[model samples]
Target chain A: MEILGYITLTIFVGAMVLMLFRKLNFPVQTVLVVVSLICLVLGAVFRFFSEGWVGVILLPNEMIGGIILHPITALLAGLFLAGALTASGGFDVLKVLINKLQKTPIGLAGTLVILIQLPVIASLPCGRIIAAALLPLLFAFGFEGGMGLLTRSQLIVLIGAFARNAFGSCGPSPIGGVGQIGEGFLGAFFPTASEGMLRAPQAFSLMLGTALTALFLKLITMKLYPEGVSLRDLPEGSVIEKKKAEAKGSFKGYLSLVIFVAALLISIFQPFGKMPVQTILVAGGILMLFMCRVSIRDLMSGIILLPVTAMASGFMAAGALASTGGFEALGNILKGFSSVPFLGVAGMLAIFVQIQTILPLACSRILTAALVPVLYFFGPAKFDLITWPQLAIVMAAYMINATTSCGPSPLGGGGMMAEGTMRADTGYIKGAFTFSSMAIMAPLAAIYMKFLTLSSFSASGVQLGRDVWLIIEFTLVIFVANAIIIKLSSKVLSEDVDKNWLSQLPAFVIPGAMGGAILAFCLYEMAFLRIIQGAIGGIIASLLIALMVPKRLTPAETGE
Target chain B: MDCGTTEWLTFLFLMAFYLSVEIYQVLRRKEGEIISFAGPDIPLGDLLGTRANVRMKDGEVVDAEMSGCTLCLGRFEVGDRVYVCKNRDKYVVSLPLFMKGRRKRSDFCKSSCRREQASIQGL
Candidate 1:
């Protein structure tokens, strides 16, 4: 039975990889669906051999219902919202805003930082929509005075910015795709824990880690491509010359943006009992469609562009794995390592990180779903050392690491879009970005977990000991190892390194303010009203900044 | 049951096998040489042969003639160096554009071409 489970699991993973790489030369959705069907058949056959025909019949539906439906519904709703936003020309407003920020090097740097931070602020269906929208603008920076090649520094900055946003978006927001998936799985495994207990600390930790990573990458970009010599300072060329004048500001676009923001805020605050995020998003999307006068045909077309079918199939595959006792087999295997002295936990974490890095897209949600159950089954009572909350912290860290690491995979969602946009060597970017992110994020996640655990204990008046200290020590060792690995890898990967100091002031100010607002909400137990007031203050400040910029005249009005 | 010696051996063997395969893949990859061409000197169509499907701006499929590269339609002269994909089967890019300090060959001729393909495919 164990062997059969392992075989089924292997088949699923193998098929996913082969399909993802297009080694089979078939449509990815078709491949995923076909593989899922095969797994179901194998699972049924195994069940028949082990139990009976009744077992075979009942298990598949139960698995699908229990594991797949909730996440799939949430994902589909998020995709629908993204579709509606695109159709309503909300993305065009974003493009216009990005273009407006390109007047100076400082402005361009600030815009890049803003683009990195947007996903956390406004959670979308994965980072694909944002990547598809913003990456072209980054690509536009590659051309200047007929010199079209992107400098190494420019490429690194663009890739890093996109990667940070793509990875960080999901773990920070409960409404985000990975967030929904993680929270759903965590809720199922640890039903007693409050949603805030599980999600809030994790979200805060991930946000802080991501913010620091983004700032570091931004600084590196600035140093390498100094303000004076940066791509923005290059001579004006055909790319800029061909830039279309911004369309007249439409009330529909503004109204759509407002509606979307309002819906997100309401969902977050939930003044009236726990309303489903999907319900709010769907309502907001419909309102936007009505305001923008968008047709159903256009909306459908936009939705079809998203990877909804692929993600659904991924969920099904994960469900099938869970049903077949494959997760149990996996846990049994890892249980051996856990028994080893000192290195046991570190070994397990290393393996998880490696797996996450290697098979990012599929593992992003699937691994989290599979592992949480294993943790619940084997934790505290079985291990007798680590508490449930400690296990939860580890799960949170894994979720952040797994989902975010997918952003740099050349064959995965955000990375594929970025490769298409940049038309550059993605192999180097994949390696460099993944390693660099891991080096920072792994330790940062550990530290955040420590902070969360310690703070909670302090508040509750409890004593903690050697186990927590051991984990921290292990994390520091891993961090040092990662730094060494990065240093060695850099020798071979070879990026241009230079030094300059010109602070991207606007870049720092906005993310800092946003972070401060969220932290205040978290620490002081501030009301949603306070958060709303801060948001309104931000909007006014933005309006004032907009007022200062010289507006471009319409082509007809200018007699072009 | 506790994880026995057999299970441990199987796990170690599997890990070693996976590691070896990954190492082999990295080592086995062929690195393409960057060569120069100028003024219609490089026969990109001939070199690419049936691998490339050239298309025009209006979504028309064109012949893979010695006119220029399908993506940019920029005529290459002798002494103009260009990068080509080491593993040509892996990428849609036939003749890669020139890039400084580029180690791995790009999968597209230009950024616009890649973007156009993505937009059309709705990727």
Candidate 2:
């Protein structure tokens, strides 16, 4: 018979990663396939035998299958989107905008920060882009400014850390979805408990607040120690080399963007309602090849990278872990929070969690599911029916949203990006973002708990218990409001020389469209309701976005 | 009488060799002075123990790039002056000279340039 234990063990060895960094050695996509195949085989055995080893290993088949499909589909879709963006020079357009912002020391610093952070908004969780772009700038700066070797290293590391945190915190991003689940779970358990007991909005707020707080602290640190620095200016001889490429007018650029976006949308969502994400992505990739006149060789070169594959694997592994009780094990560990006073718990936990040591790809899924149900089961008293589970679910979802990393967790992509871009050691900045965010979560949780506690049975706030719709709506509103703040800050920063570089970057439609497509596919497959409609809606949204974005100015126009 | 004659001969030969050495240096200095040969190179002296500027003929500037410097690549830029050390292989340039925390600019120039210009000038 199919042995469930065998299935779970296969995933455990392949999918569920330990805190050690060794697993980053393999590409995530390959690992996912290997582990997934093992699970499938065991699942088959369980189906046939219906006893013994196979049954013990196999989890709920539908959930596991759904999880397996999520990242695989998303990756294929993202590959097309990224490829199209690259082919059309859309990525270059964004880069030029950032490069132009480096008119002064402050502007340069700001640009560095923004570049490192931008990917977080789209939920691409690595900093290789940041590292590649910023390292050269720092090198150029060193050449011109005459900075000492020590100072240059310091700048790269510090800027990288800050940028990582900024990206992870961008908007009411879906990357935070897992946390949303956790909040729903936790709020159910602690309604009417004090604002201190709640974890979601409070912890999330704290994460944002603490990141800003660290920035201030960092500024103070730089001020106290004065150092000599120098940088090299580009030789007059080099200017001739840069002017060879003639830019097509802004119209051509915009048209290219439209094409890329259209392609992305069609691939992600079934505008016609029946296509798979992989099929769409492959088609989009092919279309980009034809439009750009790029060879198949060039397309492959752009598509392959360690980070992309790793992300796919990480997602698959996390899903497998969730299916096989890995999440439950983690949740059991966190159950210690129940014994602590709700008010002090979040703040205290934030300081202690050694985030850098734990690879975020492994941690996000386990933590989310583990916390969700527990929070929901223990929730509060309602007016008429006194249904505990429903109350618990609402309360838990809200609180958990704040405290957990889910997608935006500093330990994940954002953290890695910051470390690589800034040229700082990976864990250095992650520590600051994580600890400080944790501090914010503690107070926020308390406030949430307090509101729940004093809320009357007949009050509008109290009705939130049964109103799943309200919970989702309020959470979304809060998330969007925060995202707006982040975007506005980014815009203002573009003009300032000393701000983070990533903030001032113009948006790239192709990649953005690609992200939209993959996200849509993931949601559709998971929701399993009107998947085609979701896909179609996604495509339309991408096209609209492509059409609306303003054409980016070239580097020459910016006097770079 | 024999001892005195031998000592005098030895002294005369030593003086002759020293004179030829001085003459050779004078000719070299004269040749180097021609603009075509690259006009008199100036040694700015070492600004720090390991840093200096040497103004080569035609005003070519070179900075030291050091090994194992905190900067991943050795390059230092201090304002318009870039101090690159080819021998050190690390680039660290500091501006305005004063912030360099060195005792004197001339000291750095001397140690870094290593009296190359002085030798060229026949100093």
Candidate 3:
């Protein structure tokens, strides 16, 4: 079984190499499916045959009644939804509208950051997506803002946003596929969701801490180098040929817009109770298909296999490492190392080392199986502080791991960001270090000071559940409000500005929509389905608006 | 004298160093660098126990081979020179060696380390 695991691991590595180096022109979809199957089989074989590998497999019994369910299945569902929303013209309209709004390089950067930050609480690409979607926009704005190939200030914001979203109270941080696997393992190993409500002030402070960190960093960088701009000015890019606004009064055009909006709303609120996310996804997909008359061929062609393949590979590798007692062995080894005054520092170092070698998801999952069990050596008194079974330390790990771009994982956040944004460089390394020091490390120190020392805060037993939900609600509200503001602001601003000014707005508006959409998903988990009826209500609302609006312009008069 | 926490910690740090070295080699190879050796530097043929015969891109056939080096990981054939990076990082040059191939830097660079070692020894 161990041998089989090794073989599967090899195949996974080979597949990545082949794809990356262009050794094979295989469709990414086919590659992922084949790789996933190979990994699953290998894991199953190893679990049954290898005595040391018992920890790798989630027993059938466990899955049937487990808290985590099947991690791969959940991940696939999330990917399918995100992919569908992306492929359909749903996000495109929002992107277009946003581009028409911000009108300045800084505004554009802010808008793009918001868009990339939206999928904070669910299955979205936090770092990679931002890089892919926003980097080019930043490049275009760069010339106008006096920024060049690499703007240190802009990189700081990028890192800040990545760190923020990666740890945004989401069930699983979106650092990469590795994070998903690690989160799943943790959920399975400790299958209890503690319930209770903490004071609203507690929630407020925690959020303020994170947000203030982001805001401060953003402002400092902006002040230091206010001229950083987008690469949209590059002559290398083919200029977008302006298109006329067609079907101004056409019911079909309005209907398409309504459907897109409806899908966005439904994705956020999930109107139907106990309805599979896929069901709503498929319905929205169908609306896109028929409303736009987009063929199934195009849909299939647009499907990407990178996320799925990465997810499966991570699951198998982590599973193999866990079950083989590799993590447990490491934990035993860590136990032999005595305590220093700074347990947090030691923990961080251990985590950093382990991740490069064997740890997954910043050791959030592995720690339970490995580190927590070895807490006896530290003495029972310090156990609670370090074990972090209370979810505080777990949460910290999620934040640190969320950016995943910095570490040694061959499949890491940095790689994902590079791939998504098509701009791969040492900028990410700088971003990681900068953000870690500014956001994660500094705040972590504060948290340690407040909670670990000078108070019995750990024993306060404050119900964090309510606080968490409120933060989720607040974040969602901010996203939606920001999106609407960007839209309205851009429209008003564009009327007074020339072509160049109008072009910058979309960068901010589009990211605002993304952030809004993600916040909506977070809201949905807070029992929002009871208040809304999913995409249908939003579609209906849009349709009614379309009927009432006056149509004054013809398609030809709109543009060239 | 004991394998206590401090000693084990030191050992772990060394282990990390070893791992980093190996990873760096792999990275160099992946990035397309040729492998080279120092001290008892052996040629590719000697490392691999097999000679490489290839026609160069410029339509020239080379018949030279390598022999035993001071250290070797596995088999490496001739017609491969050690590709060096801008920072002078060494890697193994394989097919179309002159035309650029993937880097196959080893985790261990005895020559580089030896230089440091000699500097320390002299000191």
Candidate 4:
């Protein structure tokens, strides 16, 4: 069984690498399905050599058992609601409201800041829906769109930050979110784990990470690679072009939006008891059809098949691996790393939690489904390397890293949508995306999980009262350190591609070291040596991530 | 974070602490006001953008013949699903044209507007 697991793991890793490279031109989900069959066949063959035909029969059931339905239904429901919103003019209503909001004390940039946070607040299952819906409106704020409300820089920052938040929103979504995958694993210990045990930590880290992303875009991306950005600055001495008003919303738009919000609230709070989230979302969609006058055809049009297919197929492959004992073999292999003197158990966990971000996938669901169970095995009940509470902390960090991994993926990722809107080169914003996730969000999430999320939500009631100050201190340190890095980098940042690459060396290492050490400390409490191991682990991870960022600008970028 | 609770307050605190400071610094330096345009709707009825064509500088808001829906004014990221409405009798763009077979008209608008439309159906 263990030998088969290693073979299955090899096949899985090779298939994922193949999917990441676009040279084959096959769809990712299709590749996942093919890999599942290969793993199953190998598993069946191994079983035949050992236990004959009877052992092979149960492999199919084990593979089938891996399919998780919660996120799939939630994704479908989210699309339905989004479709209704578009059909019923709910988005127009939001635009009108946002425009009005700009006049309030928050001012334009402040209003835009809140606007960037909307996807996370809405907690949509997919980022593209809201990104698609709002990105044009963000463009409308720019000179090209003729609103002339925001400069090219502000527009880039606004769209980029919003995209950053939107892509990661799925990590904390209670309704059919990818976080539910981890929550299900955690539920074995914490009874209330499903009640968004990971929400606040992800949300907290993401908010800060997003702000740093905006800063990085403004300071580093725009300055270092002006040629990379395609949005033209206002012509010299040209007066800003006159613009026009936005479309108005009707009563039905308001009512429909209200329904969407109500459905989200009900799903999150579960006010009527622990009904399946599908029931709440589908019920909301049905009510919108009747009350909001949205057509069923329009609702049907909203359901995107790609993400759903990606998730379902990913589950099938993961199930195949589990049935083949692939997870056990993978865990053993990873645990073996702890034997190295410099890479203790804490260091291994730090590296493990961050591996998804280190090698991002197009949709986080692909790797997350396969890896979280392996992470589950690291807990006290299985390997005894970490307690349940420590596992929760690592889960928060891992899940956020996984959710945001898609943002930097060059393979048709969610961040690509934002890049298209910005008209920048394909990999222009990747460095910022990778840096923010690795250096800021991961450690911030770990600390939040330990201090706040676990303190309140854990079933065993671990009181982490004394270290609450760490949260405040860590938040301030990350914010200040990242700000100074961007500020100093801004000094040497210019259009020279090679020079810009040279400039990023320090930016990647410093915060990454702090991030890793902080992550280790959060997990190990007072173990100084473990903390050093974590810093070494952080430095190594940061170097790999930094290397992956494109060193050369594309021809179009250089042309501009 | 929950609404109106300490957790919610904490969320707002973090948001205010980070976002407000960052945004205000940049925004306070930015040189513009809130400009509004036809709320992502292809301008219709009394509000057509016959002179406000959202294309290249040399192009007029509407084509010479002024055929079909003349409300063609919007922007989008490249390669996205675009709303392909007619401008000057000829289709002058090349992106993934998204003509939802069931929609009321064949005329397209901006990719973002169309992407927003398709985002409902596509994503």
What are the candidates' individual DockQ scores? 0.03, 0.01, 0.01, 0.03
TM-score-superior candidate, 1 or 4: 4
- Encode model 1's per-residue lDDT on B1-123: one tens digit a residue: 233543344334433432443343334322233221111111111111112233333444322222111211112221222222222122222221112232223333242233333433541
Per-candidate TM-scores read: 0.61, 0.42, 0.43, 0.80
**lDDT ranking from best candidate downward:** 4, 1, 2, 3
Model 3: runs farther than 4 Å from truth? A1-69, A103-136, A144-270, A338-389, A406-424, A427-434, A437-560, B1-123
Distance from true position, residue B90, model 3, in Å?
38
Q: Give the runs in model 1 whose Cα sits over 4 Å from its true position.
A: A16-23, A27-29, A98-109, A139-152, A188-248, A304-306, A340-342, A366-386, A410-424, A453-560, B1-123
lDDT of 4 by residue, A470-534 (tens): 78888998889889988998898776677778789789988878788888898888889999988
Docking class of 3: incorrect
lDDT tens readout by residue for model 2, A1-560: 22354446545544434312233322233445566556555555555565565555555453354343333333334444454555455555554555566565757567655544454333322222233323333333332233322233344343434343333331122222223333333343445332222323333443444444344324322221111111123344543223212223343334445565575456434586644434444455556556666543333333323322333344445555445444444344344432344212221122112121122332333333323333332323211111443343224223332323322232221122221211111222332333233222322332333334324322445654644454344334433443444345434543332343333122212222222222223222244333333233323332332222112111112345
lDDT for each candidate structure: 0.45, 0.33, 0.33, 0.67
The residue-level lDDT of candidate 2 at A111 comes to 67
Off by over 4 Å in 2: A1-63, A66-68, A101-117, A120-127, A130-158, A161-287, A304-424, A427-430, A440-560, B1-123
Q: Native-vs-model 2 lDDT?
A: 0.33
